[model samples]
Target: MFEFFPGDHVRSSSVNLALMAGGSLADIGRWLGPLRDTPEAGLDAWAAAWAGMAHQQEALAAGDVRAGYLAAAGRRYLRASVYHATAQRQIPPGPTKSESYAASLQAFGNAMDCGALPLVRVHVDSPDGTLPGYLIAPDAADPRPVVIVYGGLDLTKEMLYATVGAAFARRGITCLVIDTPGTGELIRLRGVPSRPDYEVPTAAIIDHLQARHDVDARHVAVLGVSFGGYYAARSAAFEPRVSACVSWAGSWDCGALWRRRWDEAEAEPTSWFLPWVTGTGTIEEALERLELWTLADVWPRVTQPLLIVHGENDREIPVADARRAFEAAGSADKRLHVFAAAGGGAEHIQSDDPAPALDLIAEWLSLRMPVLPEPPVPALA
Candidate 1:
């Protein structure tokens, strides 16, 4: 990954994430330029810098809207949304984080409206509550294969949509980017904690999708990124509705990973991140809760077609997790692809360079899911 913050791995990863979410190099330079030498600058300073840029983009979007340049306005709003979301990632859970999250959602909605994007805000009824998500479907009227994407750790559905969801849509597949429990809106706004039995929510999401006319219910797939790799695999193991599963940077034992991090005194982007997402008061509590998050038993139950993609130089989760998942999976048809450090996507989830990984995933899904053919044009022109 590009180290915009030099020695700061946390901030550097954040920069890579922003870039993956459509942030420009010039804008990133402008935002982090002043803080380059300020070693003492903390999370507040980082949040402020990104928030300032977000406000600027929001203002530009408003001006574009006033001039009736909807497309231009939409582009600005999208950037603004990304900036706001990025800003909130640095802050601890509180009123400030809530405000920033709300702003990001609003900006993203405006972007969709102004751009006339083929996306819809969806709410799937789950055992916990109504799970919030954004669905992007192809322009075609025919039913298409659908992939339910769940983000990990601090990632939101909006960020996933901007990075991964749209790519699937372009390939004629319907994509549902969900803010699953323990991540994004659920944990941030609703205080819904992460759960080990992800299949419950996954089933609910599939139930909702099956009701949609635009979706091919039989071809439903589940994909999870970063820490979400466990969620996707676990869901696929139990949920028979899921036709295929993709673990983007698979996690074999997240609890073990957290314990290792704790032992090593690893540096985290924010102190509150894990605790907040896990719905715990401290790191120790979060680690204890995460003990049930392992896929040691879950992997053996996944009989569906499975794809495990891991970065050879992934700084967060070791590539060994991917191998473990691949070896343990009960699926007769399972493949593991590891991007080497020499290549671009050697970092977590291919954040260093996401295009190739995204392409590989799309192609893999296309072969498995098989997108429906579009309706023929009428003879009378």
Candidate 2:
């Protein structure tokens, strides 16, 4: 709700989100240099600025790849993907939205293809069709623990990897970044709606992981962001195979939040996003569908180790939700960490800078995951 652009909360938040999703300060400066001072910036203006920057990056990325500059190409492609995603979020579900989303996915694919890391595209069969996923291994030769990461609400799978999945991989953890039902390609392309029973998809993901020889199924974990916090908690509560769980923002009772937001009547972009994700035609219908999103009944069922991380200044989901979820969980090994402004993680998911939060999550998961064998010491002969 805080506005960096005087009266434009949406534009301001979009800029912050773009940076959080891996946009560079230089890119932001170039994109917003002209429009930041202009009054009454509309959505079209917002989309156009980001889209123009994204196209330029994409072109440079292609040229870099052709010139055998793989690393440079990867970085440019990643930036372009984030910019396209930012532009797509500003627009609604229409041709322009679809076009930007497609461009974002394509750029992400190009980034992966540049071989910056060993990221492979995976598709899991679901009732709706195939769910797109990216499988990144910490080491191809070793069997490592995997974390299935998904985004909340409007987040795309590319943004999830840009923010968290890459960090996990760097810390010796395998990551499966998926566009689950009701999100990303599933919603924008296949028309899948939000399901309270996230374990259904979680089960499919576990099955996919188990079938792979590189994964240590015994230590598999699920982590979710924003509204996805609710999905991860629900899956951990019901799915016996999930060894651990993390609620990035701790969505204990999303239905209650919906009710409150509806009554408040500000009608942010989410007022449209919620219904679209839930496959409802209106907010009233979406709220009715969201009745199943509460975690009151599910908390007692979570027997695995649980981690709840919340921001002290989180305006969307209050820090109290983390406390409530932690208290209700049956996990004896549960822990609650509230990052305050002093620690640089007080913002939601540590958007101002994700390093601290990513480091915390990676360290936490490292301790719980199956240990890998250490390298042999070289002989001094």
Candidate 3:
């Protein structure tokens, strides 16, 4: 949509494709690039978009579709970069709403509790790490089918605690929210970079989920939110243990993400993107760093019950990327939902409206996986 947006223009810095010998392209193909005209302008768009996100967020209560608002968010500031040579303009983040973020999630969860959803926090360990995660479970059980939820690039496991936890808790199903690579405190404290090979870490999560005897091994499922949509789906494809998978706001590759940032900031050949280029690519020859994580490599292998949900208006990741992922999945049971409201569905998850989407997910999980009731709490050990 940025292509069609009035003020938006694709920044040349988005795609610095070097041609190869003969007519053949390099294995790392040069496709589409970023959208920002320049970092200064991107800042303006960011400010405008951020200013109105809260209103659309409120729209969820009123049953907005979500895709439109999401698109507006994208079209508004599709250019924003951490690159810092000399920003043309900087959109100062308004009153830190980390509190608002938490409150909104909590309020949603509380509403669920009022209706009898059971949510609990548990300690989970990933091979070399341990983290806190929320568990949403049905009441009463001999065994339970559990779903592990992984969220997108910008979200923390804490951010999902309310969304995923509350969503599943209401369904009487166990939903676990974990901080994987490139996300939240995990990335902050642990120098773990996001890997194209997502299963490496998720395998560790599965180990933790299965350790609980109350969890039904046959029915364990995995879900990814936003960028996590790719990771969770990829993991489900390789891990024989996963019975079903859901990609909520998915993308086909990480390459697109970085490229989008470049365009949003209009960083091509511009000093503003030096920091991002340095962090993700090869300014310093960092040993373990890689820029683009493509889904073309992982999609061919996925074979599980799958569901993909995306807002047509997503500005951050073009909806086309999500469509590519959905098309690539080999799963015979795959499903795709492109949300299109007046403002847009779940605007890249800061959706003006999220309940309908969440409700849809919960419903699908219920229909696809048989619910296992929570087992009685063991008498104090």
TM-scores, all candidates, are: 0.95, 0.93, 0.63
Residue ranges of candidate 1 with Cα displaced over 4 Å: 267-269, 373-381
Q: Could you give candidate 3's per-residue lDDT for residues 1-381 as a string of tens digits?
A: 212223433321111101100011221121111113334545444333332343333344223223544432321121111111011112222232233333334433433333333446566676547665666665655666788888665455544653444567567567777767666445444545466667777777677777777667568788887778878877886787888888887668666566656656643434322333224554223222334467776776778878888887776577888788888888888888888856446355425456677788888987888774546689987
- After TM-score superposition, the amount by which residue 211's alpha carbon in candidate 1 deviates from its true location, in angstroms, is 1.8
Give the per-residue lDDT digits (tens) of candidate 1, residues 1-381: 689989888888888898888888888898888899898998778888888888889899899999999999988888888988998887887877888899999999999889645688899999989999988887777888899998888889988887874688778888999888888888888899888899999999999988887688778999999988888999999999899999999889999988888788783545567788788899888888989889998899999999999999998999988898899999999999999989779999999999999999988988888886646689996
TM-score (C-alpha, index-matched) for candidate 3: 0.63
What number of backbone clashes does candidate 2 have, counting pairs of residues 3 or more apart or in separate chains? 0
What is the number of residue pairs that collide in model 1? 0
lDDT of 3: 0.55
lDDT of 2 by residue, 1-381 (tens): 334465665576677778877787788788777787876667778788889999999999889988999999998999999999989886778988998999998888888789764687888876667888888787547778889997988888898887764677777788988998899989999889889999989988888888888777767899988888998999998889999998888877888888887788745655687788889998889998998899988998998888888888886788998889889899999898898887667867767666777778778987887658556789999
Best by TM-score: 1
lDDT order, best first, reads 1, 2, 3
Global lDDT scores for all candidate models: 0.87, 0.83, 0.55
- CA deviation > 4 Å runs, candidate 3: 1-119, 263-292, 343-346, 372-381
